[model samples]
Target: GRGFYSPSDATKWVAYESEPAQLLTIGLGVGLFAGGLGVMLGAPGVFLAFGITAASLVFLQFGVAVPVSHHIALPAAIAAAASGSVIWGGLVGVACAFVGEFMARTFLCHGDTHIDPPAAAITVMTTVVNAAAAFGFFALAKLPA
Candidate 1:
């Protein structure tokens, strides 16, 4: 009798699949909260504020990985920073929606199959979450403290 062969998993694949969901959840929460504080404080809060902004922006960008890359006349570092802030922050809702859809298709079904109903629901939920975070920041900024 022969035994079935099991293939060894690669580092990236193992890491990607094994990565804790809590990490992403916590990262998003912390990023939004810190970023909100940064925006509210202004000037002096630049480090933590922009740092959170940059992290969230990158997370959203990686989540979507949209194809279009536009160039501006600003200096290289500034242009990259501005692009990340404007594009990612501006589109976080939509990007998260897409990510939700992708996650549903990949995880819930355990196959490549896509169900429109669930995908739409997930997208809407993601959009709401992103929008809430954005508006929450705006609201927090208005408070005097």
Candidate 2:
């Protein structure tokens, strides 16, 4: 009950009205679409890395902001909790993949040192994506349905 809203709290009225399932489904659809776009754009097979990075971001957010929609049914609440991450992660994955591809061609082409520029690029991009997702999620979650 640590994250649960009190039964008498007025804030929970919004949680009951929010459409969490729709939000989650939208995120999933967007993510898959973005993946397809990445493939078409000739990203350098970074889907696995992208997924891992996204998952990490989602996990971190879950830890930091553990919101509980106690008014909603269990399944719906879970979906709502999950949708934020899925949507954000997918967007980040696609954006990072595109940027990583560009970095690979631009700065990573130099084979002078042992540093893998592509990996570094992905790492930096992931950090930015995570930060963006965190802020975006916080803002979006606070908005009324």
Candidate 3:
């Protein structure tokens, strides 16, 4: 017997999963994973320094089903970490500041100003970094404990 299978059927697919718990758990796991990657790459401080600050912005502005952005800050962070120098953090921070400012002016400040360029940039950059970090860290973590 053929029945009327509506689009709403798809929406009801995950009815058993709690949305808030799912979102929070995923967010927390991602935060910890990203932070851990920063730490493992020889930059212990980056977990708090850049991880919290940059990753938050990226997650909020461009995470999930969004247009995506410039948050590819991991490489810079990795370099900074490898250097074992606070000076490197300062340098990368300054560079990111300039990039954020330029993005704000060139994109966010136009017309209705609906989008936040700095946040978008940071978010997208971090997203790419996180993806790379996840894969890289996964490979490293799988080295048989």
Candidate 4:
């Protein structure tokens, strides 16, 4: 009599568990570091930066299932995060200036757009530049450092 026999072995499953935990820890640590740097340089809020990086990494993990799609998706997430941060920061700066100008004019009658626009523009430029530079530095730096 020939019957299908299944081997009951739990040893392989136990070994597999440890490696994934270590890998996940390493990935999270790296993501946190990268995201923290982005926030420090005014790229974006810490949560946004970490979310973007984590999403990108998660997309990339499916490289085998859809190789080309994963390749395109990861970079797209990074770029979108960087550009969005720059634009959002810039808009916030401009809005703040407008509010400040309105308050000043109402209270002190001395504020004007003649100076506010330029100041806002500079703020936007500075925020964008700093964000880009921080991103570049991280890309070129040694990993896990």
Candidate 5:
């Protein structure tokens, strides 16, 4: 029920939809703050922070009446949910944590100013995942009934 979209109303899942141009832009805005935190926190601290965020998202999805498909900050978790497996969502969430930290250390950490690792990571992962979804890569993953 709280999933991306029910089979009957598939239009609700607009996580990567480029038409409105809101979710991606919102991610960038949120990323500015998240990246600042990453720069201030350093190392696994930022990674752990994102992990908790992702976990909270999962909780919100399962525990509450929320849909995370439009959340670009946690693209991996979104992808996992699109794949129709909450377990996979948890695993992907952790892996995505590593990517956020890695992106921070590689791109943002070395820079003199805050480049925003979470933003960069989200952009990269979201593009790839959305592209895959566009190509029907996730078409095989049955939506729950």
Candidate 6:
């Protein structure tokens, strides 16, 4: 049975998928930085602020389920709710922002070539976050199957 319409099993489907917050959080950080891409600019810091705000809101909205917070707009309105994953995901987003800016300054700005800092940050942080999750560092983020 798909159990989609059943109230008791409504959330069962999430078990088959990877956590949703990870990609979108990364997206928020990367997209924002990419939009405001600049050398030593305030984009990363803004990204950081978003991370804290979004995740903390998740901590507040225990009804929506933190993993459900894939959009940056949610935090502004109802937000992710709770679930430990939200905070960790927020940290990941913030980390991506910090790293993206750092990469931009260290590798892109001083160099003559155009290496996308957001792209690099996304790639590296994706791997790092997943690796940490696998190692039980952020295991709470995973939905139970």
* Top candidate (lDDT): 5
In model 2, which regions exceed 4 Å deviation?
Answer: 1-85, 133-138, 141-145
For candidate 2, write residues 2-26 as lDDT tens digits. Answer: 3332222332222322244532443
lDDT of 5 by residue, 37-84 (tens): 333444343454356555655766565643232233356444543454
Model 5 / residue 59 / CA error / Å:
18
Clashes of 5: 0
Candidate 4 residue-wise lDDT, 42-128, digit = tens: 335434544544465465466522111111112222323454333233233333333333332333333333343223433444454
For model 1, how big is the CA root-mean-square deviation? 12.5
Query: Against the correct fold, how does model 1 do in TM-score?
Result: 0.24
Point out where model 4 deviates above 4 Å. Answer: 1-28, 31-35, 38-43, 57-61, 64-145
Error of 3 at 73 (Å): 8.9
> How much does candidate 3 score in TM-score?
0.37
Judged by TM-score relative to the true structure, which candidate is superior, 3 or 4?
Answer: 3
- Which residue runs of candidate 5 sit more than 4 Å off their true CA positions? 1-73, 140-145
lDDT of 6 by residue, 88-114 (tens): 434444455456555555665546688
Clashes of each: 0, 0, 7, 0, 0, 2
Candidate 2, pairs of clashing residues: none
Give the Cα lDDT of each candidate.
0.33, 0.37, 0.41, 0.34, 0.46, 0.41
TM-score (C-alpha) between model 2 and the true structure: 0.35
lDDT of 1 by residue, 56-139 (tens): 446445675321111100111121122223222223323332343344434443434544422453345434534554566434
Candidate 6 residue 141 Cα shift, in angstroms, is: 9.6
